[model samples]
Target: MEFETKYITADIKLSEFKGNTFKTEVMFEHHILVWFISGETKIIQADGTYIFNAGDIFLIPRNQLATVINYPKDGLPHKAVAMHLTKQRLKDFYSRHKPAGRLQPLQKVYSFPKRPLLQSCLASLIPYFDLGKNLPAEIASIKIEEAISILRSIDKDVDGLLANFDEPGKINLTEFMERHFMFNMTLDRFGYLTGRSLATFRRDFKKAFNSTPQKWLTEKRLELAHYQIAEKKQKPVEVYIEAGFENLSHFSYAFKNHFGYSPNTLIGRQR
Candidate 1:
């Protein structure tokens, strides 16, 4: 509500930018849950490419290493609303569920009434930025909630809206795996990020990549470790840490199972 930087559940915030196409990168480790109100964003990564057009909302989770190329880089011209959170947000979302309306499990997007509804939502948010500039924290939180209500009113699928709460993609699991391979990220986290129930996120993630997120994530980290020892300059222990592993033995075992060789052998062969 008041844009508290402290631990929050359903806080909403806005961002504005105008620019032309320029090579960009993502560094912040928090999952970037966003709705692109205008323009296009292109990302080139180790796997392939991702093109997100206007009217499309997507989730770019943590620890990804992709380059962003935004259209109209010079003029800038971009508007967005983002809700940032860590693992707890995802867990809390599903632990408490609703079955009454289409809003049962709030879609990572809440309910958007297609294109026109989204346009209006974006328009309504403009005043918050204006009001937020002047009001003190106490008053600002109330005003922001008012804005959130306005957003909900326009949503066609409001049946499943989470109480005082919050808030899609295709592509493949590898893309998700590369970006969000940490243990802290649970299935409920995926649902909260994508705006679905834990059940649905598990099903969808499995269908898209033909594997569960957990299994895929393990393979992804091990695969990346192989690449580093075989090609990149990172040492085995360093790559283990970089890939989010807490135990060197765990990394070693997974690496051997994945590539049929241990860290020591891989490093020895590289020499």
Candidate 2:
């Protein structure tokens, strides 16, 4: 199985997949508008599972971890067009349009129902993917603008979600950690996302969870790995990665220390 992406512009990309089934992690740095053409895409996040089929268009919020599964349909390769709305692009648009007020926190993801205008806009951009990196940046920018306009027409919430760009504010530590522990990122990243300095994050973490961030994360991940291995019948290697361990050796060491047996031993007993 292989996945490839062609850039139409710095921020916009066209992705193609030649895979029957595969799992990968995604840390979304920018808000994404996905136009599915010929595949079924399943995204599993902390909140829920979302599936996108052919001719489906959806918006994914930035700053979250997601596990994505792509499957081809009808014996064909998977293909999709993804438009990434980077922070700079959003800031530029906000400066130009100057919307009146700030936006409330929007939904994590938005799936648009069939809309002719949105579909037409996506169709017009399909040909440009063939042009590959040679596609002029100016032309791609125009298409991005057009897409934003169409989305605004379809949903008033679009403008609010896209325009009011700001760094994440302080959030409750427990809630944030519970939703994000599966991500294999540094503590500093977690601190930034929670809008706390490293010192404050550590202090708040201890107060909230009664443990250091590292200790809490390790225990939580191991617990999840145990569930996947013992209950879901998944391999330890796969569970280790998905549960946010750095590698098999560390996971194995920790799993045995925590559970008094190796993961393979558990798998053997299950069999």
1-271: candidate 2 lDDT, tens digit per residue: 3889887776777788896666677767889998988888888777877988999999988877677778898877788888898888878877787554337647567899698888888788878777644568788788888888787777776777887567789999899899879777778788988999999999999999999888899899999999999889999976786787767899999999999999999999987
Error of 1 at 35 (Å): 29
**Pairs of residues at least 3 apart in sequence or in different chains that clash in candidate 2:** none
Model 1, residue 216: C-alpha shift (Å): 1.2
Query: For all candidates, what are the clash counts?
Result: 16, 0
Candidate 1 lDDT by residue in tens digits, 1-271: 2122211124456644554433444433445445676566665444556776567655454444555556643343555566453445434543654323364433232323355644554455446555545435555454444433444455434424333233333345445554656433456655655556788778878777788777877887787777877888678866675564656898888888887878899788767
lDDT of each: 0.55, 0.83
Q: Which candidate is the best by TM-score?
A: 2
Residue 160 miss distance in model 2 (angstroms): 2.3
lDDT for model 2, on a 0 to 1 scale? 0.83
Look at candidate 1 and tell me the lDDT of residue 231: 88
TM per prediction:
0.39, 0.80
